[model samples]
Every structure is written in structure tokens, then in C-alpha cells.
Target chain A: MVNVAGPADKIEPSFLEVSTNKYKGILSWLLTVDHKRIGILYLFSMMTFFSVAVVFGFLIRLELIAPGRTIMGPQMYNQLFTLHGIIMIFLFIIPGLPAVFGNFFLPIMIGAKDVIFPRINLFSWYLFITGGLIAVISTMLPGGSADTGWTFYVPYSVRTTTNVIPALAAAFILGFSSILTGLNFVTTVHRMRAPGMTWFKMPLFVWGLYATAWVQILATPIIGITLALVIVERFLGVGIFDPALGGDPVLYQHLFWIYSHPAVYIMIIPAMGIVSEIIPVFARRTIFGYRFIAFSSLAIALFGSLVWAHHMFTAGMSDTAQFVFSFLTYAVSIPSAIKIFNWVSTMYKGSIQLDPPFLYVLSFIFQFSIGGFTGLMLGALSVNIHLQDTSFVVAHFHYVMFGGTGFGIFAAMHYWFPKMFGRMYNKKVATWAWAITTIGYNALYFPMFIMGYLGMPRRYYDYLPEFQPYHVASTIGSWILILGLIIMFTNLIVGMRRGKKAPANPWGGATLEWTTQSPPILENFHTIPTIEKGPYDYSQFEIPAAKEAQ
Target chain B: MFRSASNFSDNVDAVFLYIAGLSLIVLIGITVTMVYFVIRYSRKRNPVPKNIEGNLTLEILWTAIPFLLFMSMFYFGWVGYKDMRAIPADAIDIRVTARMWQWSFEYPNGVKTDTLYVPVSKAVKVDLKSMDVSHAFYVPAFRIKKDVYANKNNNLWFRSDKVGRYDIACAEYCGLNHSKMYSAVQVMEQKDFDAWFAEVSKKAGVQPTLVLQLKK
Candidate 1:
């Protein structure tokens, strides 16, 4: 047996033990079942994945700098874009917010020591890593990675020489991981709330996660089945979607969109939750129409599922299907509109603090509105006929994904930086990063809208001479956008080592997370605290001068 | 314009216009209300606005109104879909096969080509298939798109109003040259279509032009 020394007999090491909890050492972190430690592990892993995917994005932008292929050939370009999409959506955006920040804060917000299923929570992270590794391995295969886009529709996926099976299998595995995390959160929220923390009294972030979790649990299974069918058709010659085999390819689209349309909500709702938390704190007021905002999250989730068929409008769907989908698509916009209304109303007449997080929240509103409106335009059957598969669709999703969800991630990172690292990031660097990103984002996406209006289609490796200028402008703006991201990450990483120690309540928010020390201990709470008041109770904070002085 | 293409296009256009108009109205109304509220309740303008919790009536009204609006939209959408589903009896059948970087169109006369050809002002059905990978056949002018899947056949149809050349492209990403996989649609008058078919048949060494004999 290996010799182990007692605590008192141990020689004096350079570092202090930093003792307090039952867990300690590197192995404690690597083998940790603690939700908070697992969350931190997820956070770091996602950041690394995000950085890798960003490189792919920049490479894509680089290739599109001119009308024709530049650094890479057409085939390589296809692989790059497909891998970029897969990595960004599956590896980053889908799991990025929920798995990292959600796991860390959800339990603490609900006044629980841990999530309802802590072991499953850790298992989800490992599953995520396993899925990510499979995707990475596909890239190393003999024929190279999957050239099929993230959707991986059948027939072509059946025939493609590339490693479609491994790539698709990766997505399928990731979907399972996503479903488990969603189930975990839903159960935790339902069964783990502290005393007096009723539904209405709980924080809005929890509500947002609650809605998102429902979508994850209900919709992800369909995609799982859909992808599995595609893989089976590829290997077994089953011909479920093969036309020559008398199968219906349109049916594949129907099933794929059925899940994908709601998956967009899975991407956005948690970010909305992040925004909800940041907004009330900065505004220093109760959220306007709290019930409306909370219910709207549910409304968006439910309606979001119904609108998936809208993606199939141009896919030779029955006119009746197109009309119904178009109509339902437009209807879904109402709840999203309600959400925007409530966010703006929450800011009305409030003492607003224009911090980095608040700035991102403000930008999210403007960009998300534009994104939502454009989605309405696409939902209209007539406009969709004109804009389908065009640069307009590209611009619209970027506004929602990059502008909406991406900005929300930035806001969350800024807001939670102190809590995660126990150090404050440089505000000056953050402001500059925000300014550059805002300007760069618009410059990159806005021109695509113009090009799309001029009738330039999307996914083109080469374009007509007329569309060249817009392509040039978009490419240049992407570089600027990449620069902003670089600056932001650099600032945060450097600050972790050299930045000043942050106070517990750096933003003066009344949330339970704010009440704890910066980077709380392993158990999260020193003692489980009970909630007796609503989340936005500023009135309780007002004390007499004599009491305030103490 | 309503009769030029298929009835499906007209219905699609109608639903689009209605939704666009409604969305515009909602946008303008929301913006106006927000601006009005901000200026009216500005901190400088009003030292202390009422700390009202919520208006139950307003909440009920907004919720009920959107519900009604959604129901109406859904009704029209369902009706429009019914109209689109009934394929015309006289629809001309064409076979489409999509590959990684190419699209092949096969006509009833056993004529195969990379580009699609159709008579103007006629309902044409395309039975789409894929040789490898999934690809979406999107014709913006026709307002139709369908996925061409490997081993599976999906069909879509449309009628062209104008006799001209239009671009046909693969909407979904397939392989490295997905962007390069593009074809063209040549819409011609019936007489011109017959003559072109006859000439192509003669070139292929067929004794009688299948298309011309069928017309006769």
C-alpha cells in the first residue's frame, strides 16, 4: 500500500490547504459529483469548445471573403462550414448556456444543496464530452468529416462518402445528454425549492430554465428518432426516406423540423432567463408584469413547437400545410413580442445601471426584435417563397443566434465573472469589447439582409458579380467581430490571475446567489437559507441611517 | 396575377400579405406605446409614478386578443393547405435526381439533362430523388422547395407564368461543392417545347419523336 501522511505530520507546503469542505485536491475536482464543481468543469470545457468553433467560423468567413473559394477548395469549404455548424450548434450553443451556468445557479436559486439527481448531472457532462470526442474523431477519419450539414437529411446522408455515420451518431448522443440535463432541471425545480419559495416568488431565471427544460424533454426525442432513422437508412438500405425505394423524402423534412423548430427555443429560453436575472438587478426595480413575463416563457415554449412545420412550407408541403404553418408561425411571434414588451416595461422609469451586462441586455432587445420581425416575414408564405434559402434567412438566424443568444452569453459571462472566479474583470476592456462586437455584428449581418433583398441566395460557394460587394463587406465585418471576441476572452482570462478580489454582492442584487461569498463553498450555501419575500424586494433593503451605518 | 401560376401561389401570397400587414401594425403599435409611456413617465417629467402591480383587465385583454388572432391565422392556414394538397390531374411528371454537385432532370420522353425544361403555363410535378446525401431543390421564382433524399422520392409541383430562364439551386448544404451544384429552368411555349423535344430526339437517333407523336 502507498504511504499516506496524517494532516499534522505533513510537511509545510508552499500553498495553504484552504480547508472547510469534505472534498479536496485535483482528484476531488476530476471525480467530483458535486453539482457546482461539475458546473465549473462544464464551464471551462464549453469555453474551450467555443474557442475552437470560433476558429471554424472565422475560417468560413475567410473563405467567403471573395466570390469564389480562397484559402480552401470548394470541397474543403463544404466540410469546414458543416463542421462549424455541427460544433457551434451541438457542442456550443445548445449545451453552452444550460449545462454550464444553469447547473451552477439553478440549484442555488431554488434553495437546494444540490440538484435532484446529482450523479446524473455529472453523467451528462461526461456524455457531452463523449459526444464532442466522437465528432472530433470523425474529422480524423480516412475520407474526412461529414460534408452533410447539421440537419443531415436522408438519401444524401445515405450516399455520402464522408464520415456521416460518426458525425450523426455524435449528434444523436449529444441529444441524449441534452434530454437528461433537461429532465434533471425540471425535477429539481419541481421538487427542490426552499420553504415559501412558491412558483411566483421564485426568480425569473428559474422560470426561464423551467420552460426550456420542458422543451428539451418533449422535443429532443423526436430528433433522436429522426437521426437514428437516417443512420439506419445509410447502413441497412432500409430506404425510409429513399425515393427510388418508394419512400417519401418530404416526410424526413417534416420530422426533422418538428424537433428543430422547438430546438431554437431550447437555445433561446435559457439566455432569456440570463437576461431576466441581469435586467432587474441593473434596473433596481421589480420586473413589470412579472406574471406575464413568466407565463410568456411557457407560451413561447408551447407555441415554438407548433411552428416547426413552417420550415417545410417550401418543401412541396400541401398548400393547406403551408397556410397552416405560415399562420401558426406568425401566431408564435405574439408570445415573443410579449416577452420583449415586458423586458422594455421592466426598464421603464427605473434607476438603470448601464453596466456591461445591462448593455448586452439592451442590445439583445434591439437585435432580438429585428430577428423576430424577420422571422415573421419568413413565416408569410409569399415572402418565404422569395426569401427561402437566401441570404435573408442567413441574416435573420444570425441576428437571433449570434445577436440574441450570443450577446446573452456575453452578458451572463460578465454578470457571473465575479462569482465564478472571485475576481472582477476590467470594465474598460469589457466596454470596448461590447462596442466592437455590437458594431461588428451589425456590419456583418446587415449587409446580408441587403444582399438577400437583392435576391442573392444562401449557401453559395460562388456568387454573381452583383453580390460581390456585400460579400466583401460581410467578410470584413466578420474579422472585426472575431477581434472583439478575442479581446473579450483575453480580458477575462488575464483578469482571473491579476484582477482585484470582488465583494459578495458586486452588483447589489437581492438574489440568493448574491448573498453568498464570491465563488461559494462546495455545498453552495453555508446553511440552507429560506426565502420569506419575493425576489425583487428592495423595500426590505431600506434601513434607517443609524442601522445603515453599522 | 392570381390565375397566372397555380392557385396555391395565390393563396400563399394572400396569407403572406395578411400576416405582413398584421405584423407591421403590431410593431408600430408597440413602438408607439413604448415611446409614449417612456416620455409620459420619464423620471424627470414625473417625480413619482404610481407603483402599480398590474392591470388584470389589460392582461386578460392582451391574452384573449392574441388567442383569437392565432385561431384566425390557424384557420386560414389550414384552409390554404387543403387547397395546396389537391394535385391537378393534368400535372406533367418530371423526375429529378440530385447528387453532391449536380442535378439531373429526366422528362417523360426518356430525355435526360442537367437543366429542367417545362412548358409555360402548365402544372408540372417533379418527383425528386437523391443519389447521395440530402439536398433541397429550391426554385424561388416558383415558390417551391423539396428535399431530394437518397433512396427516397419526394414530389413537388408548380406552374410557371413566364416563359424564360430561371436559376435552380440546392438550398440545403450537401458536400464540398454544394454551392456549385446549380441548374437552370427553361420555361417555353407549348409549340417551342415540342420543336425542342423533336430536335433533341432526332439528335439522339430515335425514329419518331416521343413527345411530338404524343402531342399529335
Candidate 2:
């Protein structure tokens, strides 16, 4: 059996210091097996890919500011949006929270030295970068990038003569990386918890990662094999998804969404876990319904997989298939609603701190509600007929994926910044950035709902004159959102470089990570802690002094 | 106050309003409660919190209430869908063929036109087909859309109560000019539609086939 904790050494270097000193220069990072270091590596790569995809999205929005082409032509516009979807969905959000925060915090939260397989953890990061590089490099190769949107609906995908093969190959490799990461996480959680920790005693975040790992393991291969089949059809002219041969195009849709829909849950469930973790800490109270929240994570994973056919409602399927999918879609919304109600109730009658992290959580709740409600509207068979393939679908997803998970990511950055770096970000500036980002985000996505209802389609390079105003407003909103992001990132950078030292328990968090040193030691805990209470037990501690000042 | 023209639009819009209204209430209820909780229970106001861990009654209420609410939404949606799927026996059948960047409608009398024409308040069943890749025959005013797959057979039916030109679009992304795949549904009075149908039949007979021109 492996040791739950290392030797009791009160004075030791942090993981950063030890890893850096143990090896010289870049080799220290490149060859390190520490989970925290791997997490940082994922953060840099994900952010870089995120920034590139954001520019692609910005240009797409800019080109839509007018009725006719404002910047790029039709072909270029198609390619940009396709690349945006490929990069953002594959390279960024799918692996985002789990790769970055989960890697860094999961083992630490569970009081383990590192992940069960630290070397595999490092190998996963390498696969991520290799896959990401191939995806980006394909953009410069002949035939440019794929223009089939990210769905790569067959017939069109097989028929289109772009550099789709490379993009598909990149996604296949990335799926392998994701599968390895998920397997590692599931094993680490199973075998690496501290002595006293039990199934019910685990933090909600760990449960979230556990559920997401199962999804990553189960659902990712469907997309990987499906994408590989498409590549095969493209090269060898097999009849898997080609209409010219004896294949069905709708079969490709069913297979694609089978994985992609659950992939959305994979993206958001961890974010929900982040919300569950942050709320009780900032609220200074025990979680209202811990078991409900934990079980709901599992419920979401199971139910999320069944609702994949909802994406195929407009794909010429039978009414029976449509009804079944629509009903299952509504069924999946209950767990999410249960989570939302529990989160709001947790804040009730507690000593709440209106901190930046909590503020992001608040925004997450508000935005996720809108996303959820709109999702219901889309799920409604009649409403879906009107809104399918329109800008409404586009807006609904951004609200959920970007507004919900993206905000969850920001909250984690703020909530755990001090714990990770031992430095405090400027709280006032973070607050301002949060405010601006919320305003800009709503401004950017809200009008798409209206125009989409008024009959504007999504993925259009040049729209009718009536849609010009909404597009113009959305374009301006993109500019504002980017401005806010710039300020937020810059503030984080400056704080990391020069800021006051953070306390070990800055926000008075009650998790095991809070019990450890800020920027935790080489082997997280000197002596393994025996958990006697749940993760949110606050009776033994008091709220720390306001750590607002830099 | 409404821009709807087809029979399905009212059903679609009513469901939208039903869900949207309830969602607004839930959204407002949650947001107000959240903001109020923040203000009413701040550390300054409530320094020490009472550790009320779990309430089975409240958890059950929330879970059961949303489940019930979602089922009602599902019922309304299903009712609207049943109406859409139940095609009338007297409905006129028209063949709709979608290509790379165009829509063509074939009348029962063998009259083919680039734009769709129909009599007001009369049900028209569209037999949707695609020549190459998949496209969707979408008309927002009618609140109807169905995918036009090449090797698949699909159909959509709608009856417009008002006589006006509504935009028809390909909702599914086809190649280079998917946005350019825009046509119009000209809903006319019965006599005018009959006359227009006769004129188009004569012209269609004179010309070979306009659809073949755009065919790849």
C-alpha cells in the first residue's frame, strides 16, 4: 500500500521551489512528474489555445457587423468559425477544468502526495500539446482548415476538400489524452484518499471530478471512433456516412451527438463542482444538502448520456425518437435545477462574504439559469423546430458553456489563486473586471436570442439587412468582453509577480487543501490528516480578517 | 403584436411564452432570493452562522417541483408536435428539392418553380429531398423546419392563414453559399394561386429544367 502522507517535515521547500532547484532551467518543468507542475503546464497551453480561438471568434463576429462582408469573404468566414469551434471545443473547454484545476487540486484536496500515476499525468499533458499543435498546424497546411463547422456533418464533411483529415486526427489524439487523464483521476480518487475519508466524506469537487472522469472515459471514444471513421470514409470512400454510397448521413449525427452532448456535461459538471466548493467557503456555512449535490453529479452523467438524441430532433428522425429525446432532455434538467436550488439555499441565512469568487459564482447561477431555461425552450419539439440551426442555439450554448463553465473557471482562479501562488490578486480590480465581463458577456450573447427568434440563422457569413443591427451590437459586445478579459488577465499577472504574501487559509476554507501550506510542499502533507468532519465544517475556525489589500 | 402567419406559429409561440414566462418567474425568484440572501446574511449582519446541514423536506420539494414543471413543458411541447405531425388527408403534396445554394418546389401538375407558392389557409405537404449534401427547409413565420437529406426521405406540412411572402431558408449548412440559399414562400388567395400555378406550368413546360443548372 502507498503512504497517504509523507514524513513530518515542518520546514521544507514548496513544490515550485523544489522542482525548480532539483533540475536546471526548462528541463525542471519539461521533465517534472509533479501533478501541480503538470496543472500549470495545462493552464499555459489551454490559455494560449483559448486566446487564439477567441481571436477567431472576434473576427467572425466582426465580419457579421454588416449585411454584406465586412472583413473576410464567405469561404474564409466559414473556415474561421469551423476552426473556432474545433479549437475551443476540443483544445480548450473539454479538457479545461479537469486538466488544470483538477490535476493541481484533486490529489491535494484528497491529502495524497500526487496522482496515482504522476508519470501518466505528465504524459497526458504531452499528448494534449501534441494534439493541439497538430490542430493549429493544420490551419497553415494546404486546403486551409476545415469549413464543415465543428459538427462535421457527414456527406458535407466527406465531400468537402479541406484539410479535415488533420483536424480529425488531432481530435482523435486529444481524445486519447482526455481518456488517460480521466482514467488517472478515477484511479487516484479510488486509491489515494486520506485514511479517514469515505465516499460521503469526499469534497463535492472530488465527486464532480469523479463523475466527469466516468463521462470522459465512457463518452470520448464514441467521438474518437466516429471521427476516425469519417477520416476513413474521406480517404477510402467507404459507405459509413457517405450518401453517394449506401450510408446514412443522419447516422453520423446520431453518433456525433451521442458523444458531443455528454461532452457538454463533461465540460460543465466540474464547473458545478467548483461552484459547490466556493459557495460554502465564502458563505461561511455548512452546505445545505451535501448528499443531494453529490448524487446529482452522478445523475447528471447518467441522464446526460441519454439526451444526446435531442440534437438530432431536426435531423429527419421519427417523431417517436423526437418525443423520447425531448422527454429525456427535460429529465436531465431536474438535477441541474436541484443543484441550483441547493446552491442558492446554501447562501441563505449564512454569513456571506461578497468576495470576487462568490460574485462569479453568483453570475454563474444567473447565467446558467438563463442557459438552462433557454435549453428547455430548445428542447420543446415545437420550439426546436423554429430555433434549430438558428442563432438561438448558438446563444444558448455560449451561455452554458462559456458563461457557466467560463465563469466557473474565473471563480476557481480567484478562489484558489492565493493557495496556488501564495500571492493575493488586487481584489478591487478583480471585482471591476468581473462587473465588466458580466455586462459585456450579456451584451454579446443576448441579442442573438432575439434575432434568432426573428428568423436569423447561425453560421451565416453575410446575413440579411434586418439582422445587421443585432450583429453590430454583438460585435461591439465582443470588444467590451475582450477588454474586460485583458484587464482581468493583466491584473492576475501583475499580482503573481508582485503582491502581498497570502495566508495559508486566506478565505478560511475548510477543505484539506486549506489545512496545507499555500503553494503546498513537495509532498503535500507532512502528516496525513484524519478527517473527522465533513469538508465544510466551520465550527473549528473563524473568518479571517479581510484580505482585500494587495 | 405578432408576426406569425402559419397555424403552427401560434402553437410554437404559445409554448415559447409558457416556458419563457415560467422561466422568468423562476429566474427572478432565484435572483432576488440570492441577492437578498447576500445582503440579509452578510458577515456584518450575521456574524456567526447556524450550521443547518440538510433538509430532506426542502430537497424533495425542489426536486419534485422542477420535475413536475419540466413534465408540463414536455406535455405542451408534445401536444404541439402531434399537431405538426398529423397531416391532413386533403393537403396538397409538393416536392421540395434542396441543392447546394437553392430551393426548388415541384407542383403536382409538374410545374416547378424556384420560389414556393401556395394558397392561403390550405395545408401543403412538402416532400423534402436533397440533391447533394443535407440542407434544412426552414420557414420561421411558419415555425416549421425539416432536414433535407440526400439519401433520406423527409416531409414537412404547414398551412398559412395569411397571404404574404415569408422567407424560406436552408437552416442546415451546405457548402460555400448556405446563406445564399434563400427563397420565398408566396402565399396567395386561391384564385390568384391557381392562376399563378397555370402560368408557371406553361413556362415550366417551355423551359427544360432550372434545377439542373445549379446541380453539381
Candidate 3:
């Protein structure tokens, strides 16, 4: 074990000595145990995977523009959509905000030197990369990538000629990485809180992460087993889900949704946490109902686990079972609505700042509400019978995932970019990106709801000519969305070098993460900060002398 | 491109309209409140806003109201799902097998066809299974979709309340020809369905005859 340095050890040797040169520092960044360094590592890796997956999404949309295989053949189209689902869900969305930003900020937010297990934090990033590599390499294999979709439902998973096993194995491995990260975060939050930092005193972002960690720890193992069973069925001819062997395929749906239903919460809770942070900061007041909002996260997590079977209503479950699941699904929406109302109430008559982060947060409020409402419709067994596996289901999820978690990520990126890189992005460009993305996202997904209601099914490589208009509209919107994303990322990356240097607390927020210097030192905090009040109390700080100097 | 069909289609459409209306009302209410509050209480207008921490009464009201709204929706959904699930006793039975790139339907009279044929107004119960991958049997006109799995059987029944042609497509992604895997549903009058069945059976006679002889 490495020796633990004392606080008095001011000249402690660096973990990896780097030349003062920039490129060498970049190399050191690739292999480091420092939590801050590892967080940036996850950020870049997830962004790369996200970019590739977005390109895949574009290809799928382009193919559907005129209905009958416009851009690619049926087989290629199948691969493209499947790849997009697997990459986006597993590599990007699942770990997108939590693993990257959470790892970077969680310790700092809670006033800790580092995560409770720094080595494990670093290892999670490597495991994520390795899993991503396995998935990427499967695409290059002989028959091309697995086309069983991300769900990899059995029988087809066992029988497909594509490399289904490797891709699923990659997913299973990634699930472990997620579980470990969850376990680490849970322990860090529980055991490593600074002196006098009570659970209630911890920032809402911490509360959000805390709830998500519970979900990760409890729910990921189920998917791990479910994916493992698929692999076993594929390779060993285990008839667990193969009808020829007298196994029940419905069991696979049960097992898969058991984990996946909560996985949706895993994606959104941290985002809610991000919103909680931003809402109060911009409103310049204490959050309206801190306890209710914090508890709502926990409530969503607990209730989210029970609603998985709603996904199985049309898969031939008994009517009684369907009714039960349908009710539970609707019940879960209550907590989500609570969080939304709480956000709006938090901003009620409060001093509101319309910065880039707040803009995206407000966008999330509107878009996620639409998504949640549509979700309630799907939860109704009657409506689901008409809408399941249709473009409506597609629209509902994109609204939640993209509009909810995706916007949350973008907002957090803008909110934290200053702290992470010590630079400011061009506000004008950032605003343009947000506007284009919001409009383009709606344009792409809104028509899906209409087409779904109009009876257009999803996952088809070809469709009747009558459905062409909606597909064309969606495709055009996708192009615009891509353009917005390109501008957003380009501006951020370029701004790293050219933008003005940021102060320690540019937003004047009370979270302990803002206590450190921008682009924090390896130890993070020079002196560990102790929490005194709730995270949203901006009135506590003295007016900056720098403003007078300016 | 759209045409009025029968009572069943009308019922389905009514359900859609009801849901769409409810969703729109909620959307409008939320949007109006959100926009009004933002503009009326802007920081420029009132820089030092109220610092209200928590309101128990408002929280309870929000929670209770949504629960009530959701219950109403659930009640309608329950009735609709019950209607969707209750198949008639005299319904025709058909076996449906979904593979990677094709759908095959087998009728009770021992006739197998690539496309589905059924009598209009007679409920058809499809016992679906998959040969290789999981595929969803989706008939948008019937407003029904069910996942067909390799080792498991899932059955869904629907009556085509009209005599017309409808498109059948796989709703789940399997592989390669997933998009190309299409079929047609020919809903005909009872007499017409029998005639078509007889004609197909006549063409399939010799093999049946040979099997019977071999058994004898």
C-alpha cells in the first residue's frame, strides 16, 4: 500500500511526475488515480461514445425519411438502430452524469478530501472504457454487431448469427462497474461526510446521488443475472428462455424489466439532483421545500422499482397482473410530479437568474412534464394496448431520457464547466446551442407522438408510404439537433484555451465544491470545509470586493 | 389516407381522443401557470422575493390531486383493458410463429399461410410463439401488440369489426429483415372466409391424403 501523507507533508511527491509540457500532462491524465483526473477521463470517454451513438441515431432517422430503406439495407438498418440503443443507453446515459460529474463533484460537494475509495473510483472509469471497447469491437466482428437490440431478448439472442454474446457480456460487465460505483458512492456519502455535515445539511445534489446509489446497488444485480442467463442460453443451449427447450420466454421479460424499470430512475435521479442545485442557485433563495424534494427522490427510487411489469402488459401477462402493474406505474408518476411542482414552487417569487444552466433546467421542466404525462398514458393498460411498441413509446422515452437527463447533463456541463476547466464558454454560442437543441429535440420527438397515435409501429426498417411525412419531419429535426450539439461541444472545447479565467465561485453558490480553486489541485480542498447551513443560502456570503475593483 | 371503419375502431378512437384531451388540458394548465408565475414574479420586478421554505398544505394538495386524476384515468383504462381481453368463446383459434424475417399463421382447419385471413366480426385468438427471436405481433388497426417469444406462448384476441385489408408489421427489432417482415390481414365476411379456406385446402389436398393413407 502507498504511504498516506500527513497534512503537514507540504512537499509530497506527485502521483505521476509530468513534464511541464502540455502533451505530457495529457498523457499523465490518461493514467491517474486522482478522483478529479478520473472524472475528466470519464467525461471525454462518455462524450466520444455519445457522439458516435448520435451519428448512429442520425443514420436510423435518415433511413426512415421516405419509409422504404432510403439510406441503408434492412440488415444495416437493424445494426444501426441496435448499436445506437446499446451505445447510448449503456455507455452514455446510464453513466453519463453520475459517473462523470458525480465522481468529480460528490466528494467536493460533501466536503471530503476524495471519494472513500479513490482507487475504486479510478477503476470504475477503466471498467467503463473496457466495456465500451468490447461493445465497439463487436461491431467489427465477422457478421457485424449484435442486432438483438439493447434488451437482447432471449431465443433471438441465442439464435442470432450476430455476435450477441460478446455484446451482452460487455453489458453485463458494465453493469458491475455501475454497481461498484454505486457502492462506493453510498459508502462515501454515509461515512465520509465532513464533521457537522448532517444528512439534512448535505446539498440536494448529494441527496439525489444518495438515492440513485441505492437504486444502483439494489437493481443492477438483477440485470447482471438476467444478462448472464442470456449469455448462458446463447452459448450453452440452456433452454431457460428458448421454447424448443420448454423454457418460458416471458420470464426473460420479467427479469429484464425488473432491473430496467429502476434503471430509468438511475438515469434521472442525478439529473433531478442537478436541477435541485441549479434552481435554488438561480432563484437566489432557499429551496421552497427542501425536505419534500429530497424525500421525493427517495420516494421515486423506492416506487420506481415496483413499476417494471408495466412494460410487460402487452407481452401476454394476465389481465389482473396488468391492472396491478398499471396502477403501480401511475402511482410512481405522483412522486415525479411532486419534484416538478417543487421546482416551480422553489422559483415562485424568488430572485431568478436566467443563465445558461437555468435555461436548460427550465427547458427540462417543460419537456420532462410532457414526457411524464405521455408516460402516464402508456401506463394505462388500455392506452398501452394501442401504443406499446409504437412510435409513441419511442417519443415518451426520448422526452424523458433526452429532454430530462440529456438536458440535465447539458445544464450541468455549462454549470460546472467553469469549475472543471477554469474557463468560460461563449455565452452567445451557448444560448444558441440551447435554443436550437430544445426546438430541434421537440421537432424530432413530437411528431413521433402523432405518428404513434396514427398507428405507426416502431423498430421497422420499412413502413407504409402513408407514414413518410412524420419520418421526414423527424429526420429533418434530427439534423438540426446534431448541428446544435456540434456547436455546443465545439464552443466548450475551444473555450478551454481561449475563454477568460473563472473565479472560485462564479455563480456565488454555497456548495462546498465551490470552496476550492478552479481545476482543483490533486487533493481537491486545501483545507477540508465543514458544512454550516443548507446548500441554497446565498445570503450568508459577503458581497465580493472584486466587483468593486472591477 | 384515413377512412372510418367500424364500431371497434370507433371505440379505439374514442379512447385516444379522451386521453389526448385530458393530456392537453393538463399541459395547458401547467404551461399557463408556469408562464404566468415567471413573468409576474420576475426578479426585475421584485428583486427580493419571498423566502418561503415549506408549505405542507400545498404539498398535500398537489399529491392528493394527482392521485385522484390518475385514479380516474386508471378506472377508464381498467374498463378498456377488460374489454380488450375478453375473447368470445366461439372465437377462431390460430397459431402464429414469428421468426427473424417472417410471420407464419396456422388455422384450426390445418391450413398454414404467410398472411392472416379471418372472418369479419369474429374474434380471432392468436397463440403466438417465436422460432428464433422475440417479435411483437402488431396490427395497428386492431390496436393490439404482443411479444412472441421463442419458448413461451402469448395469446391475444381481437375481432376485426370491419371487412377490410389491414397492414401487419413486426413491432420489435429482431434482425436483418425486421423492417421487411410484413404481412396482410384480409378480414372478410364469414361466407367469404370459408370459401377462401376451402380453395386453399383443395390445393393442399394430396399431401394430407398421403399422410392419411400412411396412417391407415
- Sorted into a CAPRI-style docking class, model 1 comes out as acceptable
> If scored against the real structure, what TM-score would every candidate get?
0.86, 0.97, 0.93
Candidate with the larger TM-score of 2 and 3: 2
Tell the DockQ for candidate 1: 0.30
Chain B TM-scores per candidate, in order, are 0.87, 0.92, 0.87
**Highest DockQ: which candidate?**
2
Quote the positional error of residue A461 for candidate 3 in Å.
1.1
Q: What are the fnat scores of the candidates, in the order listed?
A: 0.35, 0.80, 0.72
Native-to-model Cα distance after best TM-score fit, residue A135 in candidate 3, in Å: 1.0
Which DockQ-derived CAPRI band holds candidate 2?
Answer: medium
Q: Estimate the TM-score for candidate 1.
A: 0.86
Better of 1 and 3 by DockQ: 3
Q: Which is better, 1 or 2, measured by lDDT?
A: 2
Q: Residues A16-120, candidate 1: write the lDDT tens digits.
A: 123223567876666677777777788888888788888887887788878775888876777777888888888888887888888988987877778999889
User: What are the per-residue Cα lDDT tens digits for candidate 3 across A1-550?
Assistant: 0111234224333322322225455766765666777778889999999999999999899888896758788878878888899999999989988898998899888878778887888788878888999999999999889988788876677778999978998898889889888999999999988876899888888898899999999999999998998888888887677777887777888999999999999999999999999887777778878998899999999999998998888788877789888999889999888888888888788766567888899889899999999998887777788788889999999999999999999999999988888778887799999999988999999999989877787787888789888988999999899999999999999878788767666776768777666666567656666566777776765442123212
lDDT of 1: 0.76
DockQ, computed on Cα atoms, for candidate 2: 0.70
lDDT of 2 by residue, A24-125 (tens): 768899988999988989988998999999999999988888988788889999999999999999889998999999999999888788999999999999
True contacts kept of 2: 0.80
| Native RMSD of candidate 3 (Å) | 4.5
